[model samples]
Every structure is written in structure tokens, then in C-alpha cells.
Target: MSETRSDSTPESGRTVNRRQVLARSGAVGLGIAFSGALSELFAGTASALGRSGYGPLVPDPNGLLDLPAGFRYQVLSREGDRLRSGEGTVPSNHDGMSAFAGKGGSVHLVRNHENRVTARFAVPTVEGITYDPQGKGGCTALTLDHRGTVVSERVAIAGTAVNCAGGPTPWGTWLTCEETEDRAGTNGYTKDHGFIFEVDPVDPHRTGAVPLTAMGRFQHEAIAIDPQQGIVYETEDAFEKPFGLFYRFLPNRPRGGVGSLRAGGRLQAMRVPGVPDLSSVQETGASFDGIEWVDVPDPLATRTPVRLQDFGPRGITHAQKLEGCYWGGTCVYFVSSFAHSTEGSAADHFGQIWRYDPAAHRLTLVIVFGPDTEVQLPGESPDNICLAPGGGLMVCEDGNGAQHVFGVSRRGEVYAMARNRQNIGTPEAPEWGEFAGVTFAPDGRTMYVNCYTPGTTFAVTGPFHG
Candidate 1:
């Protein structure tokens, strides 16, 4: 079994320090006020921990979003809303996104639409702009003016499958991943699906609609690129028996030479010693030492499950539903959506957050969500995560009941930041949808998020430095 070092101490089967508690019983705000090292999460506020967030969320008069007292929001774009190009409407199911600085002091966003191959709302069909006409899943680029208003929105890339969550590259591009593993000629798709495509935030129209096949062909969820090492860390949202394995792509050139990732790279899976069956759901706050990566024989899973066949016997660790990831504070922080013990698992938890330190060669458990209930931990399923301009991480919930964008302090205290208030529910088709595409603008003055339902994108601003 591999060994792990905790706070410079050898992990010879010892308990974690009590002060190292990752999460409290209820909201993270309660824990932050008492946590000496993490009290800065709510620094300027009163010492008393009265409310859960910056303040009570003021109800939006338009009935779309509800944010804290001082925070304000405006709609940037919505599904079915006509684009500034007047060519097509904004696609539905806005899933993941990243923001970039534009020419005229504007912010450009390359947003994903999690629609399947057969969707009612299709991106605009243009010459030399789509990958597969049969597949309706793709990405859209929205240009926002200096005032945070939508300047022009158009189809950036088209003809993909289930363009879900992706990350921004230091070289100024968006790596959009197709969540589905459906292959060519299956399900009406002319070409094989499930690959990462690069979308140019500045001008995707000129960017080739090509998939970075070297990244691997699997059920992709999100990715975070280490700028210094030119390594791409990815997550898989698979829930099958074998589950998904966390991956890192080491490009042929350590610094991503002229060809970048398209130059072809080696795919490898992560391995942590001491975890049996390679699953981490059973362990909470479990530390590991001597992390290792094993090479993948095949990047594409043609005959068998790529995760199971390549890393299962090799002892590579597996996560139930690893979702979002972000590179911040010289480390990579990611989320394991959810897993349980009822299905013969090691442990059960609503959600989890992990931190991987490349320099130290360590993977640490940063946050763990407890069991779910009607009232406690209202935001359960953490889908996509992003780093805040100030400190801490913002998580978008994809779980049940009321969905919200949750904030986790550096000390691991979780609090509600925003909630969806759109009431478009019907008896047959529910209206509530999880929040996705949570990103901050270049200047850090504004934060943009999406409500997946009647799809609306919001630009939020407030005293976020709390």
C-alpha cells in the first residue's frame, strides 16, 4: 500500500488533527466564525454568526434569482432569447463556461449547452463552423460589454454531443468536453462523439471545429490545466459499476510546444496507495502518500470500459462521480459529486472536495458533505466548481430540492451564495434545475452564473471580498 504524509507527519495509521476538521455540521458559516485559521472568510462582518451568507438573499422582483442583501444581478442571456446576430436563439441547458477579456473592455464567454444529439434547440448552422450536423450539442460565445450587458451572442462551435463542462487554458482557449460516449453511426450521429474540442474565446468562428482526440474518448465532465507543467487534469462523471478514474494528460512537449495538445500526449490514471478496489467513496479525509500515475495503453475505449480495463488491475484509484475541477493557489481542487454505502460501498457522503498538490505529490481531502436530509445541507450535489476572486471556492449544485451556488471558505466552511427563484414548474415537467457555468469575469468585479432551466445567465456583483 502507498503511504501519505499529513502536515509533515508520517501517516502510520494515526488520526487527523482535530483542528484539521474539513467541514462543520450545518452551514460552513457557523464553522468559519469559530475556526481561528479560517475566520477571514467573513472577516469584515460582525463576529456573531447570525446568517448563512453575506446576508439574507433579497428576492428578485423578476422572480429569476435570489441573492444576498448587497449583491445584485442582471440577465446576460437566456434560452430561446434571440441572439444579437439575429440568426438563432440562445441554446438550452447552459452547462459549463469560462470568461475571457475582450478587445473593447468586454468579457467573452464560451459557454456549453448540455443538450443531447436529439434536441429541440440546435445551434446556428453555418458553413465551416460545425463538426457534425446530426449532433445538436455544441458551444456558444457571448460577448458582454463593459457594463456587463450582452453585446453579441453566436454559435461558436457546433455539431458535437452533450458539450458539458470545460476549463479555460492559460493560452486563452476553452476545452469543451462532450459528456456522452456514443460512437459514430449510433444514435443518428455520423461521427464518433465524446471528445474535447478547443473553442477560441476571442473568435471561435475562425477556430477549427476539431476534437482533441488525444485527450481520450470517454464520458468527460471537466478539466483543469496546470499552466506551468502543461498538464491537463480531467474528471469523469460516470456512475456505473467500475465508476470513473481521474486522469491527467501529459503533452508530448512538457511546455505544450507549437502544436499544443493536438501534438498528441500520453494519457495516465492516478494511483494512491492503501485504497482497496481503487475507490475513494468509502474513505473520508483519508490521506495518501506516494501518489503515482500509470500509462494508458489505449486512449480510446473501443472494446471495453477504458477506466476498468486500463487502470482497474493496475490499482489506479476510482471516484464515483468526479465532476468539476479548477487550478488555483498552486494546486488543483476538484469535486466528487456523490456516493453512498447503501450499495455496498465503503462510506456514504453527499459531496466531497479534494486538493492535489503537484509539487508535494499529495492528494488531500479538503471538504466532505455529510448525509442529506430535507433541511440540512440544502445544496447537496456539487457539480461545477470555480475559484473566487477573493478566496474560497464557489460550487454549483446539481442535486435535489432547491438548487444553489454554494461557497466553501478556505477553512472548509460551506455557505449558500445564490439560489434559483424561477418558478416554471408543471405537474408533469418540473421547473427546478441545478445551477451550472459559474465563472468570474476578467476584472474580478463581476461573477456570471447560469440557471439550467428556462436557461438564464446572470451577471452578479457585490462586496465579494468578504
Candidate 2:
């Protein structure tokens, strides 16, 4: 069901191998070669002081997740485990997640389950929150103490499909996006999919099963809301011809609290004049000014996808595998998780990070992961990403070979913060799943991430430094 590849052989000692990779690439301790707005952006973050992340990863004896020496992870929930509410088992395909502060030193996490109709465990169909009884994907809410121990876990929303990566709102709610365009009766689905649903972290009852249809329905991957104007920037993960387009939803109520998005909004796709395909740009510092926004003729895609909608002569810009989005500093950062010529892309690359400056009306390439054969490094296709509390960025690998959660410093130094040693296959034919939902506690003391297969959630803590 989930994607996996076995290109590089599994190694025993990861520290030596990681160090050797960095040394050979001449990337250790060296400042990022390109200097401009990117340097200024990293400089604003506290962790961008050019310090390498918490050294090499130490292999776990349990053959699960490997982390840095001082750091350790606690299993919060597993796929087959019964939830604290005793309603149903934890669902499979843990994806996008967000952490919020709760009363009495508790923290609330609203996590997404990227499950479809055939998933083994579905988010229990709660009466009021069930959107479609036959649908088998949704979200769950987890409560943790200050010590990062799970206190309560329960279904927050149920009966959706393909609950993939989503973004947290400034008003303390999580916008879960469905990464599918399945209409009613497609694969037994009772309703249309590919819409964003808002979930409340503190109160599940407030988050009824409501789809913000104004956000445009076309294989939604992730969203980042500009805290200033409440403009929601979204990424599409379509892998077919014509690729996917970047979108921004201008909400009617702006930064209003949860459920405000349902009031209605105007959706628009981005256009960069001559740049029809984003992957064609290879240079790191390439800038596109005078950006334009084309109104999506049909946001609901009743007849056509938003990306495929005609926008006069100057068509909307599209990119391949657009995923992972976060709001930081004064811009909204989004990722393009690699492109391939064989996959019908204009150009090829491992991954790319782009920053859109709403104030300046400019879009700039921040970080570009060049073509590399080593899947063990950070240059692999980075899926879910977050601005690390200790500085820099935390990335989840969904690429090839081995899977890892990598730390990229402000100086462009890459370090392996954690590795996936969970072999879901035979010893002779090992299989590793991708990492998703990397976020931090409200106090920044603990980090929470999900291993997407066999569905495991972990809370990692230690001497974290920026």
C-alpha cells in the first residue's frame, strides 16, 4: 500500500557511514554555497548558528528506531493497540500531525491517519464526526503529560479517505487534507474526497466532519497559513501529466477561530509568468518576481481539476510531488518532493524547498537537494518538514533506499537525527517505512514523529540544542 524501495544495502554501523558520506561530499561544517535571502531567512531562526545537529545516530538494540546518543524515543501508540477511550484500535498510516498546549500541563496532538477503504484498522466512526460511514480514513487525538507520556488517545474524526499531510492553524486547530480526488462510488466511497477538514486539538466535539470545499479539491497534500493575513497556501501531490499547482485560499473571515473556513473563501492558483513547470529551474537562488494568482474557475472540480483548469494564455504553474508546508518568519515554506523525467517532469532532482514572500510578492528557491545516489543522506525526497525548535529544519524522508529523519542546520549542514531500523520484511529482504508528522511539544522539550507503516508514534527527548 505504502511506497518502498530497496536500493542500498542495510548497514550495521550508521555513525561511521554517515560521517563518511558527509566527509566525502565535503558538506560537513561548510556554509551553504549560495548566499542571499535564504541566509537571511535562516539567520532569523535561533538554531541557524551554523552548528551541526546532535552528532551521529546510535543504533537501537530493539531493532526499531535509532537516534542520537543521548536522545531516546518512547513508543506512544502502535497500530493494533487499543485507544485509551476503548473505542477502536489505532488506525494505520500515521501522517501529518500538530502539537498544542492543554490545560494542567498537558499537551494535545491531533494526528492524521492516511488510510483508505482497505486499511486494517479504521478510525472508529463516532456518531457526530463521521463524514461517510463507509470511508476508512480520518484523524485521532492524543493527550500527553509534561513528561511526554501518553495520557489519552481517541478518534477525533472518522470516515474520510487518504488523510495525508496537513498544516496547523494559527488559531490552534489542525487542517487535515485528503490527498485524493475519488468521487462518490469510486472504490466504494460514499462521498467526494480531496478536501481539507479542520480538527480541534482540545475539543473533538467542536470539530464536526465538515469539508472546506472552497480550498479546491485536487489531490491536496499540505497547507501553510500565513499568520498575518490568514492566506492558506496549499500544495498538490498529483503525479500525472500536467503535474500539480500551488494554491492559496483567501478566507472570508481571515484569522477567525476554528470553523471559520467553512464560511466560504476564494481559491486561486499561482502563476509565474513564463515558469510553467517549477522543476525546470535548477539554480538555487533563482527568483521569480511579479507573481500572479489565477482564480480557479472550478474549485470543487465538478468537471475538471484546479490544475487542469484553463487560465487564459498564461497558464498556472505546476510542480511534481508538491508536499510538506510550514509557515515561518515572514514567509510560507513549501516543498517539491523530487521530480523525474521518466515520470513526465520537465527536469529531474531529488527534492526542493521554496519560500513565498507574500509581502514582497516574490517566490524564491531556498534549498534544492541536488541529484544524489545516496539515499541515506538528507538530499532524498523530503516529505513532511517543520521548523525545529532548537533551530534549523527537521525533515522526514519518503524517498528511497533507507528512510531517515534528518536535521538540516542553517549553514546547510545535514545530520542524521534518527534512522528507521524497523524491518517490516524478512531479515534477508528488509523493508523500511517512511517517517511523517515531525512536530515539537509546546515547550519544545519533546519531539513527536510517526513511522508511517505498521503505524507507530514516538515521542523523542534528550539534550536538544539549536
Candidate 3:
């Protein structure tokens, strides 16, 4: 039996299946703001060895991708370049990325290239390509040193569907995810896209771009694995009228590792457990920025992708867009691209950030874009996020048109880190939006960013203050 809010009780931990994604996808174009799509189903890319945003400091009382000072940046990869592995070069637009610990340390990163359209490129022997006609919009795993240099690179997971935002594993691996399940039938390309894939940092050979179906299939954004409990948390990326659902998977093995997640266990969706109404959400188009959560069923041996309505009523809360999800200290913090249902129009489209504390088992609103905080930073669409090893939260702005990187201090004081665009405060030219793929050096000193379009990597270092 499926789970819903009506019969949900602390005693009954039913089964449901889903995942959460932090970095947003399908929402950027040259200089166009794809935000409306974020509320619906954003389709979103980077560059650098040919980098785009370079040179000196730009002032911004408005604060756009600001840095501490005395720090410089460089381009590591270009939109069309040959990889060290000598495989297929970077596809169209590049998205999300992860950094491993250590300076001069070899870091493994998985980037999203939203090449929805097919292109002319050389193919590798061992790799695969899905929707070859749609081009190859998947994740690429590459390695770099501490000082910001590409050591080695390869297609982490190829031949899948729309490859979107993904994160790194605590155990030294990358979790690459597919953003949609568009091709379901034979004509739908390969049956491979739409699952989480684990990529090797030092090695990309033989691991074939495989999808972990045990993680369920639908529209996936980003997923975070809880090292302590070996639980995988995921968010469904949907513009399906009402909104998408948030999920958590309890692997068969507790206190396990990433490989253990493949073992499978109980998959559950969220609901307000005791309050059915708390679970009720109307056709919000694409949202739930602050609607309270209701408890749903747990993943059972005989379960499948279940809609959220069973968990509660119909108008209690607004379904939200779940982007980035990182395991911070004692809680899981995620961001939403918009506030309410944007399946309707632009007016209801804004953004919000939230924190889910497993300890107290509560979801609280941390920051709301466009409401006060965002005003300080216009066009700020909070997407893929990382916890600063120092003491703050690093937020990558995935905007419709221009994107910026922001450093929100522990005290909620937000500062600009790096901008994908050329000019900062003044009207810029290079158009920066989709500022994502952020991670700190193992020492928490330097930061690396990814430019999906043009496809490039950047490094930021300095005596920082946030």
C-alpha cells in the first residue's frame, strides 16, 4: 500500500520513492532569465583555458559575485576543447561541480553540460551517449589540483538523459544525477538516463555511465547522502502543475557508505505525519516554499513512484522547488528557485532557501529570495549551495539571465564571491547567471566555480572574511 498523510502516524513509517537535488537545471540562456522555467521545469551551463570573466575588482553596493581582494581567477576549460583523457570534449553548457579536499590536492569534479541539441564531436570507445540526436547533456568527471589546474578529465556519466546538478561524496566520489524521465519508450532514446550515478575520482574507467535505479526514477535535481546513517535524500525536479515531492531513502544498510546505498532499502516521501491538512497543497504549478511537511509512506519491497497528494489534504501548503541539498553539521539545507506555483506566471516566481534539521525533525525557512535579502542582491536565484568549511553557507545564484556567487555569513550577512558575468555593479556585457558548481579547498581556503556555458572552471583564493 502507498503512504499518504491521512493514515500517516509516527507509528506507521510507510514506503515512498524519490530523491532531492540541490543545483538547479534547465533555466539559463545566453542572457535570458529562465527563472519562469525554474518554477516550471528549468533547463539550464560555463567556461575558462579560455576563461570569460577575468581581471580586476568590480565594486557593487548591490554586491555581485564579490571577492575579498588581491585574489585572481583563471579559466580551466573551454566550451569546445580537447580533454586530457582525449575523449569527447566538454559538451554545450556546463553546470554543477564538486571539489575534493587539499591544496595541490587532486580534486574530482562532476559537471553538467546541458547540450539538449546534438552537436558534432568525437566519441570515446568505452563511453556511451543517450539521445545522441539531442546531443549529450550529461555529467563530466574531471580532476584538478589545489591551485586550480586540470590534472585529468573524462566523461563521468555519459549516454543518459538530461544530466543536471550533482554533488560529491564524503568518501571521495561524485554523485551524478539525471534531471528528467522524458524518454520512457523506445523512441525515448536509452533507458539509462534518470538515476544517480557514482563516479570515481582517480578513475573513470570501466564504471560505465550506469544509473542507480534503486534510487527511483523521475525528475531528479540533486541528491545528498547522509554519511552517519547512510541515508540518501533526493528532490524531484518537476514543473508538473501542483509541484514536485521531496524524498529520503533509508538504505538496507545503516551506518554504511556510498556503495551501501546501491543495496537499496525503504524509500519515503515527506508528509505532515500527524496533520493531513499540513500536507494538503493545491495545484501550485511549481512550489512549496514554506508549506509545513507531512509524513508519507516508507519504501516497501513492492513500491513505485507515488504522487504526493496521498500524504495529505489539497490546500494546506504550497509545493516548493527543491534545488541544492547539502548535509550541514546537524541538518540538511536546501534551496528553492521560486516561492509559490509558477506554473502560472512570473509574479509568483521568486525564491527561498530552507534548512531541514534531522535532529529536531523540522524544516525552517533560512532565506527567502526577492523578499528583503534578495533585494540587496537583485536577480539572485539561489541554487546549488555548499557549507563553507569556515562557518558560513556558500550560495551559487542560478539566475534566469545573469548569475552571481554569494557568501552568506553565519550571521546571514551575504557577500559576493565571483560573478560569471563581466561587469559587477554596473551594467555588464558577458551576462552572468547560472553561477554554480561551488566548493572550498580541503583547507577551506580557496573556492572553485563552474561556468556551464562556454564550459570552464575557476578558482578563488585569499585571506577571506565573508
TM-score of each: 0.87, 0.91, 0.74
lDDT by residue (tens digit), candidate 3, 346-459: 235456555555645555444544422333334456777876644555677766545666654332234455656544233644455466678776666667777655456777
- Give me the runs in candidate 1 sitting further than 4 Å from their true place: 1-52, 257-259, 276-285, 342-345, 371-377, 427-431
Question: Mind sharing the TM-score for model 2?
Answer: 0.91
- Of the candidates numbered 1 and 2, which has the greater lDDT value? 2
Which wins on lDDT, candidate 2 or candidate 3? 2
Model 2, span 51-84: residue lDDT tens: 7667667779998899888999999999989999
- Per-residue error for 87 in candidate 1, Å, reads 3.1
Clashes of each: 7, 2, 69
Please, what are the lDDT tens digits per residue for candidate 1 over residues 1-466? 1232122223233123334444442433322211212332223333333233475566788878888788999888888888787868788888899999987888999899998855668776656778988888888888988878787888888889898898998888899998888889988999888899888876776566888888888999999989898899998877575677788998886675323778888787777655543334334444555677766656787766567664444366777778999887577877887775555345556777777777766776656654334323365667898867755568898876667887766544567788888866766654578899999998778889998877788999998763
Cα lDDT of candidate 1 equals 0.74
The positional error of residue 180 in candidate 2, measured at the CA in angstroms, is: 0.2
Off by over 4 Å in 3: 1-68, 102-104, 117-125, 128-135, 186-188, 273-305, 308-318, 340-349, 371-379, 422-430
Q: Is candidate 2 or candidate 3 better by TM-score?
A: 2
